[model samples]
Target: MSNKIAILLATYNGEYHLREQLQSILYQTHSDWHLFIRDDGSTDGTLDIIKDYASRIANITIVDNAGEYTGSAAGNFFKLLHFSDYEGFDYISLSDQDDVWAPNKLQAALAYLSLDRAGGYSSNLISYDNAMMRTSYIDKSQAQKNFDYFFQGGSAGCTYVFTREACLLIQRKTVNITTYKGRSHDWLIYAICRANDIPWVLDRQAYIFYRQHANNVWGAKSAFSGLVSKFKILRSGWYRDNVIWVAENSGADVKGVEVFERVKRNKLVDKFYLLTIVSQLRRSKRECNLLVLILLFLF
Candidate 1:
């Protein structure tokens, strides 16, 4: 028997580009795949499109949310993770309703996903504007070490595929309420994988056309804009709060917990204290974004 793949898709008010994305999935080269989608109280025509597709495809399953809204995409995705038919698949994937997947997306992800260990596979994505015109490719390779996963914003959930062990690790460790509320679903997964020493395979190939629009909950921004945003977040202290939340809820190792405890102390009263904290956490010595390095000082 062939291995089964479960593609988890979460949507809310995504009627505009939902059909195009669904069509792209139909063109995938991988044939042994099932789509499990949950509509989080979409008041638009999103359900109609989903119904149309489900009526035609036997492998597609419309997961019931009991008409309750999940508030955010991250929450909806987490709900999907909790409600998924765990024993029915070999591997799991995340998908956004607006992105158009390449024909080889699943094939490439499966190639890199190793079943022997708890690990994840993610790839770069070719970003597209609202008009569906290509803009630039988003590189998710900056995460060179476990520490990098916390310091930098990396891949979106839509680009990830995880083995059963990896998925189980996340499912078993996360405190569904606080974990999903404080961090994005993908970030939670990355942190949990790192905590347990699971390898993350980040491919450089762009496997999907990631759509960016005004309604995007977290859209791509320029480097300068990202820096400004980070600075603002640090100033407000939400970054520090979120980091601590993730570290505690994702079951990070002793050292991981120790470093974050230093952040929780909020002892950055001087340059000396800042240097001490950065030196303690920068164990990997891996190259990271300069802005991220600066933000580390803030915590």
Candidate 2:
């Protein structure tokens, strides 16, 4: 089997953090990898930094994201995602422009993907914490406290990796869609894994020291705001997609919209979630004000 990987990066004006992020990938425990980058019309020196890396690094390839064919940022992201189908790679990592990965990041995630399950390699998600981060738009308490438990969500875009099965599904679905001002990709993928019953892992260690700079699309919100935004993210593109709408999904496809209507008609998880929210709200009120605010902040 080919132990090859393509690190697909989606970039736009990421000059400042790009170098550090790239360096982290280079410092991986396993080096049999190719770095593929696409620039989304960056006026900043982001493209220059990529050029510098490509010049020095033999495996790296830089492509211009003309922002012409794809109508939006999500489309831009998908453009890079179609790497393996066109380029022929065994695995692809959805690399963010900002986070600093731990040296073992690739090793751990790729190792998991390479494992033999049953007969063939099944798609799995390995998400780790971006331990160190500073955010402007995201509510600090809500965003910061994510994943106290291991692999809480599917995986953050900052350090998400995909196996061939998942990549092929993504291509078939054409999932590079922007919703909620492009803050929707992470949740959408989570819903995808959930609906398809895809197995995933939430790695406890901090694989990437995620930096929460101002340019991040959206993150860090009070639990209420976070959930609301996520719901919107799910609902916007979610209203028309045909994917099954399980508890975790936003119901974007036709079936998804149907699921939402059915849920609304029958009152399913909505009441259950509302009840949980109410209980939590009561519990928070009994706790200290600061603590309650933090809990709410992370909601």
Per-residue accuracy of model 1 over 1-299 as CA lDDT, tens digit each = 25578899999999999999998888889888999999999989999999999999998999999876768888899888888547867888899999999998998778766442436877888887856454997777543554655544347889988876677777777534643544577777877777678787777788898888878877675568766876787778776677676777666635465556555675644334545445333323433234336555654
How far residue 76's Cα lies from its native spot in candidate 2, in Å, is 2.5
Q: At residue 286, what lDDT does model 1 achieve?
A: 38
Q: In angstroms, how far off is 20's CA in candidate 2?
A: 0.9
Against the true structure, candidate 1 has what lDDT?
0.74
Consecutive 10-residue window with the lowest summed lDDT within model 1: 279-288
Alpha-carbon local distance difference test for all models: 0.74, 0.54
User: Lowest lDDT 10-mer window, candidate 2?
Assistant: 143-152
Q: C-alpha displacement of 13 in model 1, angstroms? A: 0.1
Best by lDDT: 1
Q: Give the clashing pairs for model 1.
A: none
